[model samples]
Target: MTDGQFAPTVHDDIELARKMLIGGEWVGAISGKTFPVYDPADGRVIVEVPAGDAADVDRAVAAARAAFAPGGPWRSMTPQARGKLIWKLADLVEQNAERLSMLDSIDSGKPINEMRFFDVPFSVDVLRYYAGWPTKITGDTIPISYPAASGGRFHAYTLKEPVGVVGAIVPWNLPLLMAIKKLAPALATGCTVVIKPAKQTPISIALLAWRCEGSFTLNIAVIGSNITGLKRTRIRPPTA
Candidate 1:
């Protein structure tokens, strides 16, 4: 289909949606399994997306772990630097709002006009707002007293650091908006992410993942049946 002929409408066949995005790579399901994606407009099959499983989740988690490790580009960047990148991403999204909204409407079966005028623009603004917070996050200086010292001199302060490796599982209702909302805050604080977009509306999330490549260190994964496994994973490492 030509670019000008492309319209924001869900495909009639659900098998058309059968695909998986794991670690920024789009591929078929682990076992070549597929699930139907319904068109809420008429309760018809729009497409079939890859039926992701345990192994796929593991792979995505590992990718996110690597991205969040010390010395990794995402982990090594300063908070402000990371925040700036997120803001840039937000800008890109804003610039491509029309296309993104179209994708979102097609994938989620939302009204194209509403997605264009409301959902997409609001989501972009949310990302931009969160982007400004990193520059303002600062530690507090604490006053301390050492009574037993000859010449009492004590200084203490707390440093707020980014929690690493966020795994976000967004619902299908507002796939694009929810993904961006989760992504902006997590990345702004210097955390790498593995986003498991809803199986039904996975295309828009996959498109976002594709767009984010080389712009930031992000891992995109699909959650088929094992939602529980992803829920058990923590945003940060457990305290000792």
Candidate 2:
């Protein structure tokens, strides 16, 4: 297929709902506003997605924070189990690669072959690669120069832990890969994620959120919105 051509047959198997994934549940924006997502292939109206505002962003952030809280499902899960779930997500993406490619092609106006051959497969590989990191994330022991109160040198060690909730903002070009790139490592490290996919390319992310809801036992929220919505959020990375 040439750069100017679009795939003649576009699959409609994915449920193109105008909803947001908040706390692993599909729901509409609180304001009940929806925005049109255009098919760049021909500038046609592909579907309508939720126009999430500040309230919705706050809800997604809260869900992520709760998931990352102490003793929460996400925080309580074993590292090995987390890795296995990421691996499973990678497998799911692989199983639906063709459909994802087609959807991305329509959403982003990219060539079908490029999405099929490069973007989709790379996302799978990235997820698989990050899946291995959960088990490998470790800290080190250190020797302290200061003497102990009792007279001997003190023993010091560091432990690796998830920082907190992550706010990932991905661009429209190569949407699938970019989202996975932000999500894979964060999930592997036991951090809950609030994803804000580009307004033009949220359909594939919605499909991914659906698959994750079915497969993952943890919390992950993918909200749809334009730039104005998420910018209002004050996400400060946890400082040591």
Candidate 3:
């Protein structure tokens, strides 16, 4: 997080990292258990990260639910203010493009150049594109074609609002961009998220989660390795 760059590894961003982001804080699992993340290119173990279970999932879901609660910042902010914050998060993604790409490359064994060129840029674009949506969402008042009872007029309308907390599980392939696809619109529309990363490509998502913790007033939680017992509630918010 120093100098707007995340260098979690000691060897110049070559190693996988060991932390989970939950409730806007970087921490370890409650059970203190971890699993190895290996570099695909060399089949070498890069780092060991938290192996979260149903308990961790519960903790994360609680955080997201609270963040989406009536008085939370994510819920209470005006649409315009929310838009501004989402746009700011996009800017932060662009700002940390290099570090994010590096994390993805080391963890997924993807080429650094492609990650820098495509994944990072697309993530920024997706975020920026969705950032403009908060102020644009509108509801409509529908006119009924039926006669009103007792000759009284009736009004029918549809209100477009964020549904609730989102539980996102992303695959290892294209981790960064995939997470962004799930995250941007949800955040822009005033919904909170609890996301999990695949065991193989957990680095990039963790990195982005860390960046998000610093970038926005978001309650983003990252469950590690597996998604066991995370299906108790809503998996995807309506806004997403």
Candidate 4:
């Protein structure tokens, strides 16, 4: 194929989705059960993804916890370092945009041309935008006075910190872009995530895990549910 030639469209095989990524390792579902993913274009079973249960959720959470701990590299790294890593990921995404866009087109039944021209470029832009925020985050300094008259001067400052352990549950309609929109910012801000991608379109998310492997310490968990249990945890909602 020539450099400008568009690659032929290829759909994910069912067996590929059955493999679950947890704690940087690929493993089978807890119950060894699989769920069918249909091709909306024809309503045909295109693939069989793992039917994840509570055990899978637990494993993913544990892995994220390890990455979020005080001494963990993710937490200890400087914001600039984190930003650099994010930039590297953005570059990688650009490098693989064609393949990723093809996967998105197949899994979500969107037009391959649209995914190539619009969705993939938008995702890369979002990553690049968020990558610049790390260094700009700052703490506030406040003036304070002691109750006692003897006190001369006092100053107080509040530092912004990462809200650890984010559970992002995104819809299937636009799985790949949603994952990039949600996961990129959370990871950039020094938080660990357990993403429960919509069951109908799990392949793009699985592909995301594959691409993000070893770029940083991340624990991606796949669960077959619309609402994730992480909603009960201590995650702060994303600011507008």
Scored by TM-score, the top model is: 2
Candidates 1 and 2, the one with greater lDDT: 2
Q: Give the clashing residue pairs of candidate 2, or none.
A: none
Off by over 4 Å in 3: 1-16, 145-150, 228-240
Give candidate 4 regions above 4 Å deviation.
1-15, 148-151, 214-240
For 1-240, candidate 2 gives per-residue lDDT tens digits of: 133233444334334447788887789989888888887757777777778877787788888887788986778888899999999999999988988888888889899899889998999999999999998888888976764565677668899888788888999999999999999999998888988889898888887887667776557878866636456656543332
In candidate 2, stretches whose alpha carbon ends up further than 4 angstroms from where it belongs are 1-17, 147-151, 232-240
TM-score of each: 0.80, 0.89, 0.86, 0.84
Between prediction 3 and prediction 4, the one with superior lDDT is: 3
Query: Residue 221 in candidate 3 has what lDDT?
Result: 68
For model 3, what is the error of residue 217's alpha carbon versus the real structure, in angstroms, after optimal superposition? 2.3
In terms of lDDT, model 2 sits at 0.80
lDDT of 3 by residue, 106-161 (tens): 77878999998999999989988988999989899986666556666779898888
Q: How close is candidate 4 to the true structure, as a TM-score?
A: 0.84
Candidate 1 per-residue C-alpha lDDT over 1-240 given as tens digits, one digit per residue, 9 for 90 to 100: 222223434232222235555556656756767666665666766556666655566666676676667876766777688677778788778876776776667657788888888878888898889889888778988877667885777678998787866778888888778888988888777776767777667667655655666476453343433233345654443232
Q: Considering every candidate listed, which one attains the maximal lDDT?
A: 2
Better of 2 and 3 by TM-score: 2
Task: State the C-alpha lDDT per candidate.
Answer: 0.66, 0.80, 0.75, 0.71
Range of the 10 consecutive residues with the lowest summed lDDT in candidate 2:
1-10
Rank candidates, TM-score, best first.
2, 3, 4, 1
